[model samples]
Target: MTLSVHWRLDPAAEPRRSEPGAWQRLPALARDRRVSTQNRFDYFLQVAQAAAQTAFDGLFVRHRIEADESRIIAAIIARAVPHIHVVPEFPASVGSAVYAAKQATTFQRAAHDRLGWAIAPDAEPAGREAQADFVSDGDLAQRLDEFLTVARGVHRERPFSFKGSYFEVENGGFDAPLNRASFPRVYLQGSGDAALALSGRHADMHLFAPASTEALAKDIARLNALADGRSVAAGLIQPLLVRDERQTAERDARDRPLAPGTLVASYDEAAEILAGFAAIGITELVLEATPTLEEAYRIGQHLLPRLRALTSAARQAA
Candidate 1:
């Protein structure tokens, strides 16, 4: 069984300073503030690309960016991964439209075949009054159409031409046709009708937030109902902290603190969760590596194998 690993970049993993002239008691102290944005970007790109270049079959990146900072971040991402996924900040609102549009340009025009977007279902007018933004089934279907239309238009024409109630792309379409991939592969999150409907119509993958086994199973049924003939996939991402060596020093130094949070219990809980999703037809899982790079390495080296075995055993029993 092949398991796709979605490795995320950790800020703390970055080098603090350059070690000059080898192991001297006083290494060259490069001012931390002197690190250029491009330098940081290149460093992160190296980490992300190095991880991707490994044996993982596919990769998904979780990127965070400020509204104005998006272009630079997107450019960095385009340089790092062959195919990139830009997950726009969620609780997605009209405010985010312009930011999303601009970020989409970097990938849509240059990396369409290796790019995709994960959009959340838009909320409804009724819920708007309550500040609920609870997207209904109909709302999801309509929004799916709007989202895809805008995305395609942006990728095809340099000047934005799409005009929708939620967003309008102006002077913003791709100058050249999208290579290979016609439309960006979309992923959506949520359990509501609107979310499910959107997934059926537009999303290639559905990301399930922390949920119980039964709840996830029911969601799979709901999603499959709408997805008819198209190939629809599902994945789960759970925060984890892994430590294989578990030495006293390493244990104390780990960022997750192991005593609290679900980090420690995540191993078994995640196993059960993966089993549940697999039973219900969910195909992929993106395990959130712990905060410390050491812990992440441990998880990749040790924990992943156990999970792999569990999946194989479950499959054989079925």
Candidate 2:
């Protein structure tokens, strides 16, 4: 099977020097402090295009609370990038699933045949309160289930209805022409039992967060079992650190202790690392090669070739 590879849109994974956060990194690019907004956008476009060239199947973009919207950015990306799929996280609780379905179709206009919907099923109590304008505290799990029902229902040729604890939709359907893939694939990221079970029943893919290798393995197994016979891609998000050789990788890891992250050593070592992940049933990898553009290019140029070469082999062996 072909392994699905994904990368992020955020060029600066670490907090910027002027930003308030635990760790800060200054930009090392040749550009000066007098960077214009358009210049910044162009820089990101450069990295994005590089990622596209490197053969990432998809791109993930995180949503900023009220400040920066992800849908607009995703649509723009869909237009710029040729065929790469874009999955932007939407807080499902923010709006009706019907709204999300229609919105997903509209967003697909730009990315047509290259869009997937990744939803944040719920938020912490404090965060939910802040979004009182959008969603409220309730059985978010049930809400998520209802959402999946409504979304899938609307995408079908026949009208669909649902009666549930949280949502009720009657004869709901979409008339707009769908992307080549029809409705965008739905994805969810969460580890709770409710999340896992619902994801098994609804999501085409389940996105995993950073965790120990062993932890991720166990979660993948549980999700696979929960999915029964249905096909669902299991994905992990990792930040990688790679080098030409094992010693170089080790030295870099030591030099940047805080950012050591996942060490992908030589091409052979990288293949072995990927093999291990595939052995544990990971079909998708969404990773950050580095926080800055330089590191992004370095990893993209170096490790990407190895990744592309060996992922399918590893999966076949598994």
Candidate 3:
């Protein structure tokens, strides 16, 4: 399982495609843009195993979590495979601009398992209390101080400490080292100047919504510029509003009329759509479901197979 497919679990009711009496129309809504959306709690363990059993390689659980919770989730995922990413949160709402800032300030005090001053007194692999990273706003020096402080506890090899507007720390060390020498890649999703800068400096991966290939290429290049040659990777998870069959992708993109610009109309169209993303340096794409679970199932069961076949043929020919 080399390719990874992560489900962005934002639990919001979009307007359905009908009337109030029949089936209401569903509008565009992404509650969290994090993987902790509802229904997933029930199916996550199963889904994780399923993905591991199948061709997909890893799992990334979203939501800002306590260290204990993070460790528990990581351990659960490690049983099947060792790669799991814990996303703190996604600023899905434009109105809540300070949401991340507030969360960052309290990050170290959330809970035993949360990113905070305290962690579970006793966690497996031992000494888990030292991984909390402080979050704040207003000053870059402060934020970097906070980051360095937390990175030291989590890293501990060359203990880190700093004093600045947002944070201050000294001689921090981890209670227990990471199971893996280095941390797994962290992921972020947003399109803001601050968010982009933070991801470029710290995040291992970044996600984006669907966009034209040319547009997406520019976006990736912008992010790369922020990275300053750091080894961060990028991914795109476009909505799969089409089918592998050329007719399906075309028909769906043109006629389905579920979400405007949601479908691609045909497989060839879908391929062309994806080629644009790949060209933009997107490493992975999570083709989303249409409007309902049934539609999602149809894609997983039907469209995926055909697309996979077509992709295989093209690869061989190339």
Number of the predicted model whose lDDT against the real structure is largest: 2
- TM-score-better candidate, 2 vs 3: 2
Q: Which stretches of candidate 2 lie above 4 Å from their native place?
A: 11-40, 133-138, 176-181, 211-214, 246-268, 315-318
What tens-digit string does per-residue lDDT give for candidate 2 at 189-306? 8886767888899989898876667988888878888986888888876677767788887777776644334655765676567656766777787767555456656666776677
Q: What's the TM-score of each model vs. the native?
A: 0.63, 0.81, 0.56
Runs with alpha carbons beyond 4 Å of true place in candidate 3: 1-4, 10-40, 60-149, 156-158, 175-180, 192-194, 244-261, 290-318
Model 3 per-residue lDDT at 45: 51
**Total backbone collisions for each predicted model:** 11, 0, 26
On the 0 to 100 scale, the lDDT of residue 13 in model 2 is 48
Q: Per-residue lDDT tens digits of candidate 3, residues 1-318? A: 122344332222232222133332345683433232333333335444544444343344433323124433443444434343223332221112122233332332232122311111122222222333223223433343254335434353435454545444465433332312333245555675565676677666767666677777777877888887786567775566665566655665665554434655565566555554554477755545544334445454554455456545555665
Worst 10 residues of 3 by lDDT: 112-121
Could you tell me how far off, in angstroms, the CA of residue 155 lies in candidate 1 after the best superposition?
Answer: 5.9
Go through the candidates in order and give each one's C-alpha lDDT. Answer: 0.55, 0.70, 0.45
Overlapping backbone residue pairs in candidate 1 total 11
- Candidate 2 differs from the real structure by a C-alpha RMSD in angstroms, to one decimal, of 4.6
